[model samples]
Target chain A: MKYTILFGARSYEHEISIVSAVVLKDILKERIQYFIFIDSKGDFYLIPQDKMNAKTFSTGGYEKYPKLQMTKGGFLQKSFLKEQFLGVEVMLNLIHGSEGEEGIISSLCEFYHIPYIGPRIEASVMSFSKELTKLYAQSRGVKMLPYHILDKQTRNIDSIPFEFPFIVKPLHLGSSIGIQIIRDKKEMNYNLDVAFEFDNKVLIEPFIGGIKEYNLAGCKVKKQGEEHWIFSMIEEPKKGELLDFNKKYLDFSRTEKTTQAEIDTKWTERMQMAFKALYHHCFEGALIRCDFFIHKDAIYLNEINPIPGSLAHYLFSDSFVSVLDALAQRLPIAHSPQVRYLFLSEIQYAKGK
Target chain B: MKYTILFGARSYEHEISIVSAVVLKDILKERIQYFIFIDSKGDFYLIPQDKMNAKTFSTGGYEKYPKLQMTKGGFLQKSFLKEQFLGVEVMLNLIHGSEGEEGIISSLCEFYHIPYIGPRIEASVMSFSKELTKLYAQSRGVKMLPYHILDKQTRNIDSIPFEFPFIVKPLHLGSSIGIQIIRDKKEMNYNLDVAFEFDNKVLIEPFIGGIKEYNLAGCKVKKQGEEHWIFSMIEEPKKGELLDFNKKYLDFSRTEKTTQAEIDTKWTERMQMAFKALYHHCFEGALIRCDFFIHKDAIYLNEINPIPGSLAHYLFSDSFVSVLDALAQRLPIAHSPQVRYLFLSEIQYAKGK
Candidate 1:
């Protein structure tokens, strides 16, 4: 069946999306007809994944490629794209950050009646904004650091109640684009200015010190009886002093120290509870990585990554489920029902008319 | 500039959007080259407003009419849509309810670098979801009716912690689509079932009896070298019973009542404070109408229409500024500096490459 991999968003994680899409193409190559959406200059191109091997899908090289245009001139005007993608079966979304995580694409997919692998629009929007996500999490009794939201016009940084050694980050940006750790009030202005460079709103949360960062990646799949089955978790031990953008991405030429930390039954149960709480709260579909900080023997959820790096295959590798098997299971579960409904609804409407 | 009036969404207010867009066409025609985005069979058609006039942009007739496919291929192809919306200078979003009010169109415009005349995406999403909006409002000390949220899996409606004569409404749907007044436990299941027809989640709020409904429409515009200026307030006097969807738009057809109502200075000041608070919290561009119920001396905010009916021009008609003047002021403010920055950044990155 024809399939498309949506990637390369107009977001800070656009480059990361390209990498994820490329890796996904390698895995899904034998199974489906895959294409990458490389967003450049606010335009999207349906480029073969093989072509993306030569250059990175970034804003710089975006305009160099030709893109599919939806024109008012009807099918005859842009029949090629219609012929190529209309025949396709499913969409594998590899987009991250802003619109990717905020349910715009999900809504569009719903409008189009296409089957996609990931959270629905409602869950996407709830998870995308840090403020909204935290609020929902708080309502669900999830322990989180106290945060003070600062808007663009916020003038008095000194008057902020949150003491220094606070985490300052954009409310909406992903991949740690405008995240800073302010050590003192003197550094607050600098950090706030830096955070404002990326977004209009900043979330200032009290830094949870004396904690080891843990990256727990797992896949939540729905079985026949409406039961959710969560796979074994993969824990990533935090390397060095802090896990900033470079450290998170291992971009600073540092060989990242990643180990599969053993989870006891008690901690495993706690992790499961957290996952279920988040899943029930509104997350759905495929693999999601939940980042947590353990301080004083308590696990506090940092944030949830709907679309994690490398599709977080390493987490499932040890459990004997290849990334391909997991993808196969997740994709069909995500796509089939939605696609059938679209066709059925169209037929019903046509008959009614 | 090449522009589009995106309306006729899969919203409860789909019909209202048609009226709003049709009326707005007259105001925007001279300055912008616009087309109406008619949603038919889950795809968007960029039809000229003139064509829409000949054939009403209703769901039934939309499929029969020729339309511009917004995507090159079917919905799954992200690249297909990336090409279609290119060069569209502005989008005047008139669609209300789920697709419009929930920030889907706003986020898409932001991702596609298309300027839109409405609230920012974050604010729109926050305001659209009744549960989240009320929670946010409550956090900010906004006066609202005591309510309980009921999810789809909620069993035993009689067990809810609310008194009789409560209003049950689908949490996200706008225009009071599935709103029902439940006088007692007998009506609980019927009301919930009716609300479930529109949405999966429902809100049960205490019905404010013997209260007059008011509509306060205001616009936020930025003048050169100054902060944003909010225009005068317009209050709709309660004519008959409770203000429902039919009563709202079909008010002209009902028994003729006073077209205008007197706004006491104290109430007007309170209304201004609410509007300003909303503006600071999330609202950015265009005009918005806030519905309120005055019970005795207390004012309870009902819901806010980000893109109110006819842009709430009826409210500005008798004010210091004419409806045309208000539109003129509002149109220019649609050119958001923050949005301009996003466009410029994309363009600059493209040029640099």
Candidate 2:
């Protein structure tokens, strides 16, 4: 019953992850047995029992803690540490943005055969990418705003594709970090410059007028040994225009207006329909936070957060811990059985040679 | 001026990778200083200088070769080896399929800051997934066949979107490892069972009759410090009625009818048009191999091999060494600069707290 809560990584949302960790620590305090923090530069830190606090996580100068490298084994390794095993049974991944959310960390977990509590590598990677997510949504005939990709080499700000009054964002960043709404031509350069600082590639999406933003969180639970996904009541964040970094982390409690439990059945049905449609096209991870923009009859899948903050804890019943515990009980459910190569065999090599 | 030719990993195409290494050895033998082979189980073996022949590669029992692990410093480390530093400046990545081409090893290279000679992690991952690749193509108006995804949990062989005469393939495997043509409903279960052996998710694409198969190899080189992509003269493989695993590797040399230097500008223009369009989206890395199907006026992107066989050596010049040298000189061309933070600053954190 060992649990290691992993948080913090090299992302624009580094401190936000720490905040998410603080929230997680509060909810799953009795459950978590160990803590690991990844620095902005991608260094692993094992927090000692005495140093485990919200302040310690926020500050993140864990020079005294043991630095780790993930081997084929699931547990943390310090190359030459006196103690070899840390007895990590399940990894509670609270990593937010960039490396952590973008499937790199999840892939690392997969390569190491660790049971991580989020989307699989492919899902994480696809969800983290705005371009890929939009494309998948588009293929599935999901409503989406017109978007254009501007690469550093071929296309740049000098050659903008969309008209002004467009939203430009870094292709892979989360929590609306490098995002700007260009109202006019003059604001284009500055917005593009700011966006490029986060990612070399930026996605220019046409801004729709009279749009309402709604966030719906989804979770997968096992019922009668079969996977059943549950959707939460939709929340409309009061944050102006866009849910920027400030609105996401700071003064976050008043961020969204959400119902406590069972809302209108029709509303729930529509939300589930949207969620299920996006899920087939690759909106994934164990706990998923999908945002949509509704303008009259049109509903566009705005984006998906694979590693949603505190695993989108507030959306579940009572707290995120309730759903997390349910999901955690089915640990390593996603783990593929031993790969039996259909065409690959050692004896076949001898014959082929 | 150290060059280590790396090949073999846990893929159904493991033996095929060894054959590809043989092809690479013929082309890059003069420049290659060391050779490393990764067995199917992901064990690293430092191939002894003497035991570097095709016979050795085709039959992999390198138990005596020193085991190696990629360190954070971007060099191979063996805990028991006499020499700690391998002095690996540039890596020639030849490992095929799953672990090799799917960004796991590429990310390992990225994490270590090693100059891997292939598509970077993002491009590799995107190209590795058939569903994503097709979706991206669909987004850009790059014509593709009608396809549906069948997940392990949701859909079974009984439920297929495409009508009879469809192709069932493992979504992520390469070299036609788990692929079958389901000509009728009777064969659907068998094909799906076969496809699922290689991957949990399978892509069901409408099989096009009387379609021409073409292989186009693309290379990226630096001239006057400016990036230029070079395309190979098109080849029409003779491997009829689905290029199966045996046809792809064993009798591969005789499969293609490729014009050596120049032919058909109009045709090349059309092929290059498709290649360049895909490139603009994600046709990345030092080298890329894209397969296409053209039936009537319709052209569809079939699949992309991030690390094509022989490094797609044959498609380039008389030898791959020429382009490898040109690309190696521009070591680490894919590195990016600038990391903008939306929030999560230490000074800002202190103030917020």
Candidate 3:
């Protein structure tokens, strides 16, 4: 079956997506017939080897090349996109922000009636928006910092209810882009300017002080031949100040201390409950990495990466589920003949008499 | 500036979109330059007249249309899209339901860096999802019907803690599609099946015994080159049995009984406050139609349509504001020189070395 790995979108995390797709290609090589790559520039290519080289075609630039382009009048140039998947069975999505996480691909998959693994469009959109996610999380009793939203038209910054030392970021951005820790009113103006550059809406939250951060990566893998799914291990960053983007991604040369942390059984259980609630609330599937800050023995959810980096393979230790097993377990069933028939019928009916 | 009118999508309200785009074309003909039409089959065409003519496009059938061809590597062609919106400046979206209302187009607009007139992506998605909208409305003290979400994997439908005589619908569908009023277990099975067809998630709400429907159409209009915006008139649908899809759209032939109803001025004041709260909460602009049912003199919000049918132009009557004037007020502001420079600089930075 032909396998496609969609990556590198028009988002701040586009590079991260490329890195993720490369890593995933290595892991899924033998399991799938062929891997197709899509990059941030709206290009599609094929991964020739373990180390995929990005290239450009007349249609677009892609790593693992695919011949397809959405043309001027909304016409599908069949010759370009109708490549038999060479038994291509599934799409491994490595897109991070924007259209990737917010359900564009999901809707396209639905429209094309293809089986893709990830959160449905609704959940992805809700989770992608910090305001929406915070609202849902707060309603579900998930711990979050008290925050207020400010629009571009907002005139009086003095009226902001939150106290100083607040953190501000674009309401709909990821990868900590446009994040600013405003220490006073002097910095507020500068920070707001930076935040507004990324988006029209800005979110200001009172900074949570003095808390250790942890990355809990897990795949909601349905047990082999079973209906039940289980959460994987929890990885704690070496105790220190918050790791910025550079430390997290670019500074990989430095052996940043990360180890499996010892969590209290009760705390682990609570985290599991929160994770499950989030999974159900967001209707997310496959791998997810949830970040949380521990303050006074209580865990506060920072954010969720529906399409986590490296497919969060590192989190699944040798003892637990492997990447291959996790992928196999989470792979969605292709559209049944009955479902396909219904879709075709709807399309025909829509054509009108 | 080039202008494109994006209409006709994979929605149940595809025909309604065509009607909307045609009407909008008639109104904006003198105001804008060029108008490109997007048909229901996802093909683009030019609407020669200011009215929709099914005979012109429908005669050829969707598949036989000039643009209907699959590409080589399986991606839709882009030449057709470019030709359709060659000189388009802004997209006046008339698409309704699911992908349209759920933020796919908005996201694409953002990706392409094109300006559009409607609710932004996040708000659109939230407003359409019944469970999320209800939760948000409840949070804002907006009275709403009590409803519970029934997930697909859940067992024991009887365990849901809700009263009988419930109305069930797909969580994120619009136009009253797949909506069913179930009175007992015998009906529950059938309604659930119907709802599940539209979406994987379903919302069940206890039917509000007494129903008096009202349609409040208002737009945030700039008052004569001023910075402040004002809301337009609020029109109440003539009180009667709930208007179904057939009565609302299909039977426009019937004389519309909707007239501005007399009510205490205080009601208008309160409703305005509610509308403003929602506008700020969702960061919405342009026209919005708020549906409400008064039970025991208490207004309970059913839902909000960011892009209501006919742009809810009927509600603007009696008010000094005309639909054309209201639309003119929303014309996109060309970026200031400084702002444009900043935008270009940021894009260059994003382009990276």
Candidate 4:
């Protein structure tokens, strides 16, 4: 089966997506048939194997490749003579933020009926917004840190439940681009202004100093008729006041192996249970990483990476192809709407009579 | 200001979408530059003005038209020699049910940077599933009928809170496609099976026999800098048991005047207020209809039609072009993620130094 590596959409993490795609080329190897890149301007390109390097994209060398067109089943690349189908039987969504996690690729894949390894539309939509993610977590009986969503129109800072020092994050961003630690009331407005520049809404929560954050990546695979989860070893990321954009850039671009965090077995089981509660029926086909904060001996969801950087493959030991194969066979089928139009035809028949 | 009318898709209401598109051709007249149809098979076609009729789609005559390819900014049509851009500045989403209301067109339009008149992804996601819609209503302080969601895995019927003669509806479907009223426990299993055939999840609500249902369609348009709503007259659709797919078939095909429903002005205001609460910050840039059931003097939200058939033009006397023009100008901007990779560059500079 032919696989397509889709990456680099109009996102803040566009460069990170390219890095992930470049890493995937080595991992996917001979199975990849097309390297589809969506530029920051939202144009599609079909990059050759040799042109998969970051320099090719950064230097504008990708312009030499044929521009791809999104058609029914898959993408089409046109030459001087005719159009050719990329024949992508399956797609691996590598774009991290924005279009990748915000339901564009998921919607396109679902509409085109192409089986892909990524969060479905509902999962993507629920996870894209921090406020919505909290709601989803609460709906699934998972604990989340108390937070308040403030938009551009929100004027009452007094309404916030959190006191003195708090953290403000752009509602729909990841990789900690517009996240800021607000120390006092004086810094509140300025930090909110900065966060609002990245997104229309911002999520504010109490800044818990020295909170232990653990990251776990996993996916659910169906075998025969039963489904089970395959979880990766949890890793505790190095942090300061927070892991800002600079620290995350190094984290996003890496493909190296890291040792698993040494944590208690009971905590591990508790975290995995929380992850399962959040993932189970909601995130069926996607490989997702969930960051949890252990504060006051309670696990609270920090955020969900619907398409984690580098697919979070460094954390897992299993072969991605086999897991994706198992998932693809059991993807949630789009509702088969009754297409008979029998009633309409019957009305027409009566009118003719 | 070229406009594209997008209709049809893999939906139960595919025929109704064609009817809606044909009705739009007359109302939109010369403003439309292209009539793009997504067939039941999910293929795209550029239907010419001459072939913009129900017969063209019903008899599969639309195949004679040029096949369209979705490109970066807009759709592209390939001829014998070369491909041509449709140059669509704005689009009106006319497809109903599945692909129309399920975030495909919304995601595509947002991804491609095309200004469109339809529900945005979050709004579509919230309203597409009946369970999510109820949650959204509760979150927004809007009243909704009490319901329980059941999946195929749900074994015990005793878990349901409602009594006999309860309503069973496919969670993700519209137009009453797989909705049934279980008169007793004997019919519950059979109805659940039928509803499950349409969707994996089913929403069960107490059937309020002879409930007075009203539909109100409206849109929020940004005038100058302030956003205000333009609401159509409230409508009372004829219902028998349930407005099944057949009754909705006739209802979906109409392009005529509908009289404003005669009801208490206070009740009408309450319903409109509820609609406002649901649409305000959520469903920006889209024209939507919300169905409400008035039971015992309290207004309860029934469902939201993200893309109402025929655009629900008959409910309003205002010019759609003007309203759409205002909406297109003020469509919610996609989050401009921090594109400057300044942090990454700074890290590289530090390492190089």
Candidate 5:
């Protein structure tokens, strides 16, 4: 079975994606058939496994590699008289931020009929937008902190129903890129201006000081003939006003060093139940980490990381390869809605009405 | 501007998409630079303008044309020693169902930085799924008919809170392909089975008998730095138990003959306001048709047609070419989140953490 690792797209988290892919290369080892890197210009390049390192991409040394063209199902390397098929039985989406979490790679995989290991387009859209995530959580009966949206078009601050000490986040960004904590009225305008630089919409939520935040990663996998959820032990992340961009960067770059959070059995069960409610039907195939805030003995969903950095390998107990293998075998088959063209066939035979 | 019309992907509404593209070809005439037809196999073929007819695609005659490759930004034709760029400045999404409304083509356009005249990925995802659309409507404070979802995995009918006389619809399908009106409890199982054949999930809503249904189409256009909504005259479609697959197919095939619905000004303003709420920031730059049900003087959003058949040309009075040109000029510029790789560069220089 051939597996392709796709990473490094035109995103703010391009370097992080490279780090994730590099970490994955060490984990997946010889199972990977191709390391397809998408440059900032959105061109595909086939990087040799031996040359897979941070320097190769950072120094733009990947330009010398064979360029690949995206065809119907998979990529093709155009050379001399024939095009070479970089056979990909399954693809692992390791890109982060915009192109990855926001549904570009998912769309590419779906359009080309390539089975991939990541959030589907619908899940990506539902999870990527901080604004939409709140709606989805509400619909699922998953509790979320009350929030207000400030649009760049209107820039209306009066619409906020809550008091001061708010957390301002760019609506569609990941990796804590454009997040600021506004302690009072004097800090609101400056924080909003910073968030508007990254996205048109900003999500302002009540900043609960020293909130209990837990990160749990899991995925629905099929074994034998039945499907069920495989959940990871929850980790209590160190929190501040928020983990700033640099801290989040270092956190995402860490590989395989994980410690489970110590919590009561009842609380763990309750949090897991909330995760199930959010993950069940919408986020079927993707491996995701849901960050939750335990507020006043009630669980509140902070956000959904559709494409978690390094695929959240450290969270789960089993080896990433085995989990990925089982998932790849039972990857959701896209139902090809059979088109008989019965209507068109009948129209061709009939005369003008 | 080099305008491209992309249509027909492995969708149930493939023929309807062809009909829509043909109608568009006639309307746009010489303004169309290329008509890229995607066959059921998800392959791209450049169909000649003269040969653009129902018979051409039905008889599989399009296979003879030069095949095109989907590159980063646009399509390319490879022959001899060189690849010719198709030169697409803007593209019009004409595909109808799965591939189009499901966010595949939108993702392709977005990833490649091709300015297109259709719904963005977030809008497509919100509108494509009936269940998600309900959540989105609720989030926007738009009224929707109460509904329940039936999943294929659980096949749970016991969870439906609604009584009989329910309308069962496949969650992800357009064109009214697998919709059934259940008048009594006995018809529930059969109707649900039929709807499940089209999609994994089915939405059951109370069938409002003879509901005052109206179709409204519109888009947001920017002119001289001012952005405003351009709404078309509301349309009152002929109602039935439901327009089953055949009637709906015929309706979608019609072109350029429309009548302004004799709706009262107050009702018109209300419906237009609802349309504005649904379309404002979420569905910017795309021309869409929203079908609404007016019951008890309250407008309930039925569903959103992200990529309407015939581009809903008849709904709007203006020529689609001019509307498309205006939209193309002001198509939302995807904010490219800049990455300096300052952290990664620092990591390369640092000896130890």
Candidate 6:
């Protein structure tokens, strides 16, 4: 039951990833055989800590940690470490945004023949592309907000079908980094420039009014050779007119605000069924989390978080340690790539690594 | 420039891939610096031949070639060889079908920081999933034949909206494998059973009648500082009611029987624009080839070949060797992952030797 814990990339979520990885390492400190931190520049480092807190990354002088090298054997090798977790039984991937979650980490693991927790490359890539998710989900009757795609090549703002107060989002960004509510003509160019800074492709959609957001986290649990999708108690977060990054993280943790609690059995049943349908549509993932907006009793999906922050550990009743252990063992089975598309080994690749 | 020519995989397209690789090896014999081959079981080998013919792979006993290892440096290294492709100026990838074309090879190259040809993982995975491709392309107004998706969980064909004389294709397969033309109610279950063998999900669509097929090859050619997509001579191949694998490869080369030649400049211009739109929507592929149906004077895409067989060399009057050399140089500049995602060092990880 060897484990390799990896996180902290150059993404905007770098700090959040650090916090999650350190907390996860503390929770599963005894079980982990290796802890590797990838810097914003994609450099691998051997963390020299037995226990970590939120401040460890900054205070611990992590830059002093020896830079590690990859071996032909697929192990991240260092001069001092006796166990590198090269051929570990599983990789507990805690990476959040960008390449970390966008199939790069999973692709690396797949290539090296190590089973990884959560989604595989195809699922990660699919989730990373929000428009693709909408198209696939809408086909299965998952209600979604009306949206239009805009890239660098897009010239006409007049062509946008949505009215003002529309939200413009960089297609590939995570969190609310480059999202802006364009209220009028004067606001259009500024928001477009802001979004263009983060991503080449952007998505513009009508901002739903009176939107109440609900977040649900779930896992694919395997038992007795059969699989079941088990969801946790849903949480509704109270938000400002818009949940900006500052409001999301600085004010308080999004987890603490429980504006709405408990999900209806029938609604949960319908959601699990839809998720299973999407899963069967060539995506492989586990411990899935989703955000939805309930406007006038009709649910519109905000996004699917394949690898949620803190792994959404708070949602499950099981101890976070137990969840990590079980996930390390079970995620691979649920993440199996079918022979449907000339099935080959996973290690897909680290995009924009 | 040092060149590494790679191909062959375990997928159903294994033999076709070998034929392609062998032919490519012969065409670029004088220029190739090294040759590598991957077997169906995902094994890699070093090939010594300076030149290879179409017959080489079956008679090559490539298994006898030295088993090679991938270095952390992204070089395909073997002890006996004078040098590995570590930091090769370029890699001419001619792999077809399976992991070879499905972004795995490209991922491997990407992880090693080598810019290989064809679509990146996002596009490859998108193209690999027919349902996803349809959803993405149809949104861009890419006229596609009406189709329905039927997964293993589907209980009844009676529920399908498509009528009889439907073509059932496994969602993930290529090269026409596990495809059946269901002409009647009696033929439905058999074809469903046939397709289910290849993929868990199947696409059922009414077989378009009088479907005249057109195949066009194009590349993401760079001229001046601006990039332009130039297409090859469009070829229309006569079909025997259906262009199954047998009709596609074994009977005769699909290239020879060109029933229609010369693409209307206007049609090619429209197709290129559609392709560029698809590309900007996060697809990164060069040397793109597409199959289409001209019905009612409208274009309908059947599939997009990211790495067309033999790189669709015959379609272009340019020398095949020169195309490979030029592609090796220009592909990387056009393959940047954009700026919004935290910029990380692209050399992420190389797992499992």
Residues B17-110, candidate 1, lDDT per residue (tens digit)? 6656666666556654555564633466555556655244432445554455453212121343454333455566777776777776775566
Give the poorly placed runs of model 1, Cα more than 4 Å off.
A1-3, A54-66, A69-86, A218-220, A232-236, A251-260, A318-353, B1-4, B23-32, B35-37, B43-66, B71-89, B251-260, B318-353
Residue B275 displacement (Å), model 2: 0.9
- lDDT for model 6: 0.66
- Residue A59 deviation, candidate 5, in Å? 1.3
Give a tens-digit lDDT track for model 2, residues A209-279. Answer: 66777778886667788867867668765667776767677633222324643445665577678788777
Worst 10 residues of 4 chain A by lDDT: A338-347
lDDT for predicted candidate 5 compared with the true structure: 0.86
Q: Model 4 segments beyond 4 Å from truth? A: A318-325, A336-338, A350-353, B318-322, B336-353
- What is candidate 3's TM-score for chain B alone? 0.78
Which candidate order results from sorting by lDDT in descending order? Answer: 5, 4, 2, 6, 1, 3
Which is the leading candidate under DockQ?
5
lDDT of 4: 0.83
DockQ (CA atoms), all models: 0.18, 0.31, 0.18, 0.50, 0.70, 0.19
Using DockQ as the measure, what is the rank order of every candidate, best first? 5, 4, 2, 6, 1, 3
* Chain B structural similarity (TM-score) per candidate: 0.79, 0.87, 0.78, 0.96, 0.96, 0.85
Instruction: Kindly report which residue stretches of model 5 are placed more than 4 angstroms away from their true locations once superposed.
Output: none
- Measured with C-alpha atoms, the lDDT of residue A105 in candidate 1 is 64
lDDT of 4 by residue, A1-353 (tens): 66788998888888888878887787768978789998777778999987787567766778888898776678878787977986678788888888999899999888777778899888998999888888888888889999987867865677888887999988888889899999997897888889888877788998888899999988887776777788888999877779888678778767776668999998999999999988876788888999999998899999999899888877875566665566666777666655664544565567673
How many clashing pairs does model 6 include? 12
Determine the C-alpha RMSD for candidate 2 after optimal superposition of all C-alphas.
3.9
Error of 4 at A246 (Å): 0.9
Q: What's the residue-level lDDT of B7 in candidate 5?
A: 94
Cα error, residue A67 of model 6, in Å, equals 6.0
lDDT of candidates 1 onward, in order: 0.62, 0.70, 0.61, 0.83, 0.86, 0.66
The candidate maximizing lDDT is: 5
> Which lDDT tens digits does candidate 5 get at residues B232-350?
78899875768877788878877756888898999999988899999988898689999999998799999999999888888876655677777778888887766566766677778
